[model samples]
Target: MTANLNLYSCDLTDISLSIETILQVVRESKGIDILINNAGIGKFALAEDLELDHWNRVLTLNLTIPFLLTKYVLPHMKRQNFGRLIHITSDADHIGFAEGSLYCASKFGLRGFADSVRQELKGTPITVTTIGPGRVDTFFNGKKPGDRPISLNADDVADQVMHVLSQGQRCEIERIYLKSTFE
Candidate 1:
């Protein structure tokens, strides 16, 4: 039978609601085969001029939400003995970007979090992977490929995710970094 899928459109910054929703889903669902922590937000602001609220919002969505969701899902995954978690990070997690201090910090934090959890889940069927893309041409900033010629398309990242999931049960791809050929 195909695994049930539920897509939640709640804001990640709302911790209480997000955590509650995650717990409720896992508690009610039969099993969670995979959890993709893809929710994220970006903000363009210099470190010196960054607003506190903006930083919090970006960090909340990019970092804390994934952590909370993973925390709630771990028990279910552990019991089932099979799970895959993918955190959609960014190249900025390694290479800092100008005017993107908040975004970089949040993504970097997510990368670290995923790494730690991957290690913690060692010897278990629950595998964690982090996919970092350079620049995806999405509605992230309400921009299109015509508006930003060098950006990669969202499908590029989606394909990578699918490929990772297609790997054999005995194999696990830890990380993937996709960049635009033109960049």
Candidate 2:
């Protein structure tokens, strides 16, 4: 399937480019059955020290990009009455940390966006789910997999994504929170 998969590289931060990317996918695929907004970037800084450009960049990738993608794909989903919108958020969406004001704001906004859109699509086949994981063991922020014992494996979250996708048609998973236990 990798041989048949076509990937288009675009700067998602650029609204025009992002829209074009989505349009291209829709045109090639006929219609979008699922959308996973998994791309994100984090710039950690105290609220007082965060610059406007940094804040805008974080919000653009974490919140605005997802919103735009959803907006573009939603019409097709609504037309077909079937779609799955998945947004990979962070535990920062639920709680704020010392130097994560910008990150938290963007994540929190995404969580809220998922919730509101879910409501709007209620009674439809389309489902909006948010998977918020805590301290995933990835290269995020230059942290390695085993850098923190309390961090979760990337596979852990992938399992949750599969779980959400495997649910029965009658079942609607609104949100899921994942965190690693420190033993």
Candidate 3:
């Protein structure tokens, strides 16, 4: 039988709700073998002009929620000796843009967190991977014109995820960064 898929669509800014939803999935499902943390939000504003609420919302979803979800899922993954975590980060984590202080901070923190967790999971089948992509044409920050004609598509990221999953248990890819050719 196919494992049950419990999809939770909520404002990821709600930490309590996010944690509760993940806990519910863990409790109801037979087990969780993979987790794809693809949820994130961003705001473009000068660091000085950035609103506190916007920063909090971005950090909560892009950072804390992932950490909490990983914390709750680790036991299941450790028990089964098998798990895959794919974190969707951004190239901005490595570089910086004029109005991306909050976004970059959150993503950078997430990448660091993923790396530390991967190190701690050595010798275990639980794998942690962070995938960073440049200017994907998504409604991530509201729809916009295809500024970069050669920007990576969302499918490109999906293919990366599939590639990671296809790898043997002995292989663990830690990080992948995809950048747009135009930039």
lDDT of 2 by residue, 1-183 (tens): 353556778898897899899888877875677888988899997799989999988899999999999998999998887889999998888899899989999999999999999999989999999999988878888787678757798899999989988987688888899888862
lDDT at 152, model 3: 81
lDDT of 3 at 157: 93
* Each model's backbone clash number: 0, 0, 0
Shift in Å, residue 120, candidate 2? 0.5
Local distance difference test scores for all models = 0.87, 0.89, 0.89
Candidate 3's displacement at residue 65, Å, is 0.8
The CA-based lDDT of model 1 is what? 0.87
Model 3 lowest lDDT segment of ten = 143-152
Worst 10 residues of 1 by lDDT: 3-12
* Candidate 1 TM-score to native: 0.93
Q: Clashing pairs in model 1?
A: none
List the candidate 2 regions with Cα displacement exceeding 4 Å: 1-6
TM-score of each: 0.93, 0.92, 0.92
